[model samples]
Target: MTSLLSVTDLSRSPDLEEVSFTVERGEVVCVVGPPGNGGATLMECLAGTGEPDAGHIELLGVTVGPGDRRPPGLGAALRGEALPARMKVAEAMRLLSRLYGTRGLPGRLVDLLDLEPLLPKRFGRLTDGQRRRVMIGLALVGNPELVLLDDPTAGLGEGSRRRIEQAVDEVRAAYGGVCVVLDDLAQAERLADRVVLLRAGRVLAEGTPTRLIKLLGSTYVMGVPPHLRVDGLRDVRVLRGAAATYLYGSRPALEAAIQDLSPMSGDRVWSIRTPTLRDAYLTLSAVPEPAALEA
Candidate 1:
């Protein structure tokens, strides 16, 4: 089946490079990576707000080139997009609904996003989280075939983030359209059907959450002091961070390594846990660039 959205060989100098991905209907594809990884630029290109230097985007079966207007069935809730400060939330939603030709108010979206209380308030009076919820609601006004949400939950409190996640789930259940969410690794793990990991303006990895976590090739992660050494241990991959040195390996290897350090003071601390998407991301990001490895 044809994808709802296809981005092929998309590039923008200094921000993106040959990035390609597809989003099938009823799927949520979260794009995530470290800071300066070009996610913002990619979202702009997908939303048709910024022209890519090369390649193309196909949205809902229409091929869109650089400088072209965004396709009719595409909706975006991009970060920093502004609404008129004087406009009430309900008024904004109704206006967008009319503009998109959707019948009546987006009542389902308002309830799904828990916006009833804020509906009477002006855009400028809402807090960051409330404003984000409103933006998402506005984006879904027309039930567009493809939805682009850039960092929708950025800087939100836990409660607000959960509400957004729930709202996203409700939107998917109601519309079944493809969603492309630009977020961090944690949110990607919770919200994405598949994740695309980017770094230095290039695709690093892409897969379901479990599949991406498995890329670390370890069942457990043991964290110890950065100065501690586990170099001689078999099957252990060491990732030294500023705060802790993570040792990624199987259960037996970690157990043996811990035993070897049993004589250390009780105050010496260590921790062991299963590998997560964040761990896989860190491991992949730590890899030497292809050119450096080849050299």
Candidate 2:
């Protein structure tokens, strides 16, 4: 399997400390981490919009770092991309089509993004979701071999979100392009073939979503009363909420703890389930602030 993009020991000053990953062709790799932890920087580095302070970045057989121009055959749509306010959707698409040597929508991007009705709409007048759908179409205009998306569906309504998700699946399957996405755990689970967990700009864990989730072993979540002091459970991952004390651990261990506690009240209401990518993510990332941990 040939790697479409590779980053070796990538580092940037404040946000990105040291990061590395490989994106293979036809793979949707999701990059997840604590907010403000440099996931955006990583995308920029790959897209050549920004350069890393140190380390190597290679895409499509081309090397890019500080001062190097972005290579062709790659497309990216980062957050807050500002399109010309007055430009109509058709006009913008036409211009991009010319630039990419495509006379119209590249492949099925027009239909995939449901952009037909939006063609006459002004960019400024479009809602955030509409703008994102346009941006997604724009990214595909060049028929790129790799697409770098920074939360493509973030802040959108459910309808637009589902559309983008469907478009992504279709694009990857039809075009065999690689995608590197920066998004939340749920989206990562839905879209990623491989997941990278980052904290403080460093790679904490990287593997298939299932593989990472399995690292924690058969996890069972038990709910206890908030007033119950659970500081004694040294071997479990606990998330305390206002109404319930959520305990995450192996089924047998949680059962043992429950037996030891001998639930007196509502603590009897508990549920056990397998750990998800979100669970593994929370466990690996940990809570950012001390307040989140203090019960």
Candidate 3:
């Protein structure tokens, strides 16, 4: 089946390097990466706010190239964009709806984003989370066929982040369309139908959240002291962090490594749990070292 949105070999100087991906109908694709990894740049290119030095973007069968007008059905909520400080949320929504020629403020979107109570509040008076929700609503003004959100939940608290996640889900369900969200790995794990892991303006890995996690080839992760050594352990990958040294391997391998450890007075401490997408991201994005275990 043809994808709803396709980005091919999209490149920009010093930031994006031949980045590419596709979004299917009704699917939510999250581009996960650290800051300055080109995730935001990718969104800007797709939104037609930034031009790509090479390659092209296609949406709904329409090609968008450098200096081309934005496609008709594309909507974007980019970072650092703000509504007028004195404009009330309701006024802002109505104004964008008119600008986009949309019917009006969508009741479903208002409910999904919990914007009813915020209608009367000025943009400056609304909290960051509330303002973000309003921005998302503005982006959806015309029921766009493709939506691009850059770091939609950035700098939000855990509760606000969860609320945004829920809103994304509800909005997708209520209005069927393709969505592309650029955010951190944790948010990608929660919201992505397919995860695109980007690093240094390039794609490191792309797959479903489960598939990406499977790339780690480990069922469990054990966090031991950074100074502890497991010299005899095989088939385990070790990542040395400032706070803890994480060992990724199967359950039995970790158990064997634990048994081999010489009893240290009460000082020996370790923790084991299931591996997550963040663990996979860290492992894949890490620079190779002489002591690092290969998959």
Best by lDDT: 1
Please report, as a residue range, the 10-residue window in candidate 2 with the lowest summed lDDT. Answer: 286-295
For 164-250, candidate 2 gives per-residue lDDT tens digits of: 888778657865555555657878887888888877788878889888877666557677789887877756777776777778887
In order of appearance, the predictions have TM-scores of 0.92, 0.87, 0.90
Residue 161 in model 2: shift from native, Å? 1.0
Per-residue lDDT value at 170 in model 2: 69
Please count the clashing residue pairs in each candidate, in the order shown.
0, 0, 0
RMSD for each of the candidates: 3.2, 4.9, 3.6
Residue lDDT tens for model 3, 167-265: 677656755454555656777887888887788888888888898788787899988877777555787888888787788888888877777664741
lDDT of each: 0.81, 0.77, 0.78
Ranked candidates, highest TM-score first: 1, 3, 2
10 residues in a row with least lDDT, candidate 1: 286-295
Per-residue lDDT of 147 in model 3: 79
- TM-score of structure candidate 1: 0.92
Superior by lDDT: candidate 2 or candidate 3? 3
Lowest-scoring 10 consecutive residues by lDDT in candidate 3?
286-295
Model 3, runs deviating above 4 Å: 181-183, 262-269, 287-295
